[model samples]
Target chain A: MALAADPMAPIAARVARVRRELKDVWTIDIEVGSGGFPFAPGQFNMLYSFGVGEAAISISGDPARPNTLVHTVRAVGKVSGALTRLKPGEFVGLRGPFGAGWPIDVAVGSDVVLVAGGLGLAPLRPALYRLLATRENYGRIVLLCGARSPRDILFRIELERWRRRLDIDIEVTVDHAAPDWRGNVGVVTTLIGRAAFDRHHTVAMVCGPEIMMRFAASELVNAGVSDEAIYLSMERNMKCAIGHCGHCQFGGDFICKDGPVLTYRHLRDRLARSEI
Target chain B: MDMVQSDERSILTRAGLDALIGTLAARGYRVVGPKLRDQAIIYDDIAGVGDLPAGWTDEQDGGHYRLEQRDDNALFGYAVGPHSWKKYLHPPRLQLWSAKREETGFSISHEPETIPPFAFIGVRACEIQAIAIQDRVFLEGPHVDPHYQVRRAGAFIVAVNCGKAGGTCFCVSMGTGPCAKSGFDIALTELLPGTSEPIYVAEAGSEKGAEILSSLPGRAAQPAEIEAAEAVVTHTAAAMGRSLETAGIRDLLMSNLNHPRWDDVAERCLACANCTMVCPTCFCTSVEDASDLSGEEASRSRRWDSCFTMDFSFIHGGSVRASTKSRYRQWMTHKLATWIDQFDTSGCVGCGRCITWCPVGIDLTEEARAIRDAPAQEAKP
Candidate 1:
């Protein structure tokens, strides 16, 4: 019975770089002063904007480069807006590397299908980076991204660079676009039907709006993927990322603790129910 | 965990009761107990035995609470009140940390905890169970709440066996109380309070309690006196005011999430959050940030929050639980159904505070019975 360090206390991490990804989204690289922040693929950090508040933002940086602690934030709320407005030299309080991350080890030697929608892609970026760095370990890596429009797309350059790789297959879709658009023009779930991957061995990781995840999961199920092979990254309002705050509860599970990456087999019954 | 050593029993008189309070106060502990305050029994700092509500008992029902005079001059005659021992351990408001703007970025520092050890007097058995439930939530979880740990680590407990059940009590149905089962240093049962020679049959539940009892002016209780103490709890067990059938309760509520009974309860539930505030085990909280007018320093603090609030489940666009039916359903399901899945134990101890303190008189036991009686054909979306 020894006392542990305070879980709520935030360490001051100085912002090293801020890249504006979209109109309101900014990708921030923070220096945690310790020079190394070891975190898994999909774990999130509670980013605090000084006096504004805290928001649960996923660690979007590459796990190999632990010094470059990164978080991509959308200015959808007060705390996130403040974080997005931060400059390169400003400081923000950081408390995390929290929650269960994506099952990268479980997907070894298996084909990986990553379906991301809007800001949801930021959380999945770390996992994709890991899959590509260890390209020889995994099978066909397919990434399908969906945005409201071409302008709303995140990591546009990175998507193209990854698509250039012969081992990976990448597809981008927009819900609505101008006539100049020359790619997929439907929901991200539609790409699941035509994606080139072994349906029997593919481990699908989907992240997006709850509605989009539900439809994508249903589409995956229709594509001959087992329910246990499909994993979804869910979202909810959160305060304490350490599970002390009860805000992120989804039925029996605390998304902050048990998830934020849960299998469809685990969430199938609870996910279909509304207002859970 | 069952620390109660029933083999050791003693009888204490009125003079001995005063000595117990005096001894606790001398040990540098803040002795808190029930007191007559604002026409109700509230837990507060007590100086002596005079602060105890002598002959007052509370009459409680769904959405109704009144203080009544009892025939006997028993100190702890009433059931639980609106204020629970949580107000001392997990305070309604606590400062987590503070930050000051500096030249090179900023610096953060936690609020140095300075809480005195408390000696909770007159704690009910159901209330003790509630404290244990909170211990699991705060201490036994993956990440412990440091502030709660500091406040709860050194507290002393003195559990009082109930003489009569409250109008809304269901501790027997919850298998929590009527008698002090465990989690107390000492347990006391008031006996013959109306007679000239009133006494308290006491048992030490821990070594600390045995030491304190040895110092108190009490004698070994006769076998007849021990039977009287047991009889008091037996009478209370048979006199539960309400009961909840817990068999298959988890599946019953989880399977009927969309039952119409939720809508019926929502019609009466004002969602004032009074029930959550009064509930002994409701531990949800929200944090707030405050800064000086000069904007040089800022501090963040946590305040008790309820599921009834729209902001409790707010994401970016709007609240997840926007409708009253959804909110009410969330509260009840979390308490009775999902809580068991999350904590491995039911969140509720059946203290009945939620039923009695609800302004609209919405009783969960009735709502549960309604859904159980007529479950929906299939869970609607």
Candidate 2:
């Protein structure tokens, strides 16, 4: 079989625009020539700069947004810094919205719980927006968000609007609070213990730091949610977003190809390994 | 037909052979055959028949090789070399794509080179198998590498039947060599001077070979010459010094993943990647990017990569195979064991190139034997 063509070739993308979401994070809206980049909410693109190399950035825009694709990037590495510094007219490379994403269809008709920590919220926000857009399909929509500090919370205005809606519950927490802050004080997992959830009917989706996800999943499990009902988005050093390169293998699974999103039941034993 | 007539074979005198070589050179084909280099047999372009390493033979063992001169003048001499046909066909590094930026947009280009035609003068039977193995990898895979296909299609192979086998050769076990039975345009067996008749038993295995031979100054071999070729192949088969127990090898290695033998070998193994470099079938690679000092534009290039490298399994903040033992185990197991699952054939060709090229002289055959011989130890309850 002929090898697939190189997917990372930079497209002629004008940084359609940029919007500062939080203190450190900025969203760059790009006009991609390849129309309708069909990406699930949790999939990511390997964003590339002409000279600065590339980094994996999650797709943060609405899946319905066809002409413009949005990526919320924090100034972490050389490529991210270059991406954050780009003006509206500059260009960047976009590889894919690769990897398996949240099973939105499976979560339909079920009460939903979105547990997001720090930058993890960026991927979940799209799913939240989609669910809220068609609120009649879901029973109850709850979003539990946590950040390092009060100012670090992303989509603060959106969180406020969601909190005002009668059909949804928005609970925000921070590891540390500033002088004038009034909100949940502990980790996001702490708020989960207080929320009244029908664990049997709820589908929990958790994405965060590894330690945070472990604790959040444990809390969900303790509240009677089966491992099969809990989904987590795994992060790995994925060189090729395809399965050919063995870099992103976890046990027998290629995380880049098989999943960046997998139910806890599928990975419980494999993730228990010391090295994984 | 005459069964064993001495005069039936048309003898190409030494001078006639030289003249034939000159005629070939006058034509466009670059004739590459075997030559003695660096105390080992290596393939090189020959100017004439004199450039051939006549009367030279090599002794090969695990991690050891030495060429010894012979008293008789024979054109096709010595066993396989470190370099396979892959060097010319699937080069170590080649450009796949190039991009140039313009005001409107970026213009990307894929410039695949047209492969040049060349005659391989003395390809061995096992090397032929190696070429076939590479064909499956480069051509039959999901993504056909155009560069390899171009070169492979253009190569004209002249296979030399092995009259003498190397000590380390286990092609017999691998079902590969000791005779160039097929897969060549023309096959040759050189008869020694003291033999009943001095001539080459040449047979055209392809139409191209028949055309080339018809044009050259040589005639049909006699029944006696054909008998002599058979005798030489039988002798070479009987002379095989090493044998591998290939029976149930894939299963044996797979079931013993946690075997202690891996750690024993890892103690001496440097993970230097020499084995992979010399291996004919190993095809793992990585991509690299380079840019001008101004950091305006960059080009990405793919280079040969080895599983031995730490970064090969890097994930997030750490490496999956952080220990040398794990990395070595992964490589050996992948080659000898799991490769059957991936490629539907045993990865090791019993060519002994990895054994000879290894800096620490760690023999894979020996390691396999050790693992096989070791009594199964139960893990702690």
Task: Name the top TM-score candidate.
Answer: 1
Please provide, for model 1 over A162-198, each residue's C-alpha lDDT reduced to its tens digit, 9 standing for 90 to 100: 8888999899999999999998899999999999889
lDDT of 2 by residue, A74-94 (tens): 886566888898888877777
How do all models score by TM-score? 0.97, 0.76
As for candidate 1, its clashing pairs are none
Provide the DockQ value for model 1: 0.58
lDDT of 1 by residue, B332-352 (tens): 988998889888888889889
**Model 1 docking tier (incorrect/acceptable/medium/high):** medium
Model 2 residue B372 CA deviation (Å) reads 3.8
- Interface RMSD for candidates 1 onward, in order: 2.8, 4.8
Provide DockQ values for all models, in the order shown. Answer: 0.58, 0.21
Each candidate's chain A: what TM-score?
0.97, 0.94
Which lDDT tens digits does candidate 2 get at residues B334-379? 7676666555777777677877777788888788888789735432
User: TM for chain B in all models?
Assistant: 0.96, 0.88
